[model samples]
Target: MSLEVLLDTNTCIFILNHRPPQVAERFAEHPIGSIGVSSITAAELSFGMHKSGSEKNLERLKHFLTPLAVLPFDDEAARVYGRVRAELQARGTPIGPLDTLIGAHALALGATLVTNNTREFKRISGLALEDWL
Candidate 1:
């Protein structure tokens, strides 16, 4: 169950929209099953789809998610989240809750996080990160 990379919500959206060539190329480098998403990302995408109220977008999102593995925020991830959140808070640099969860999940799996929001994701120590965009 070795996961090579975890796609962030932003990356997923970019892939779906096909607006950025670099991101698409980066994503193409990885095998379909090797790429994954946090359950948090799935939820976030679903939220955005619901908010947009566009059936076409919903179908596109569904098709986009079909091939990628979705990682869960299990107990180990929760523990990591607690430590990460506390450390960030002590440092007075709290990030978004969803980002924290994504970071924690990536850390637990030892997978690199792929996101354009490196500014915020980099705040978590020991979490590998890459920005395709």
Candidate 2:
């Protein structure tokens, strides 16, 4: 509960009802702390929930993200995104677009990314990430 975090999209879904997620406790850290989400994740979650047609699940998601500090997908984030993407690619390690963008947002907020995909994220230099698992 000591570290404030920005959740990766997968982890955010767990916030709704996945009790066994190792990082669920991290969300409690931010009852007052801002839980940052990438715009891509917001969209992905909305799409999944929409397709699932679970009003209860959708409500839970809204409540989960409606509060807390948000890092909007903006021009500044785009600049960082390009820089990070190029840097990673130059190193011959390519990550998914969503992950690259999420890492950028996490860096923008100076918060550690809470994710289980540590191996992929660790490749980016200077980008701080944590394994919720």
Top TM-score model: 1
lDDT of 1 by residue, 11-45 (tens): 99899988698898889899877899999999999
Query: At residue 70, what lDDT does model 1 achieve?
Result: 83
Each model's TM-score? 0.96, 0.85
> After best superposition, candidate 2 residue 72: deviation in angstroms?
0.6
Candidate 2 pairs with clashing backbones? none
State how far residue 127 of model 2 sits from its true place (Å).
Answer: 1.2
Rate residue 2 of model 1 by lDDT: 59
lDDT of 2 by residue, 42-126 (tens): 8788898899998987887788778755557788778888899999999899898889988887776667888778888887677
lDDT of each: 0.92, 0.76
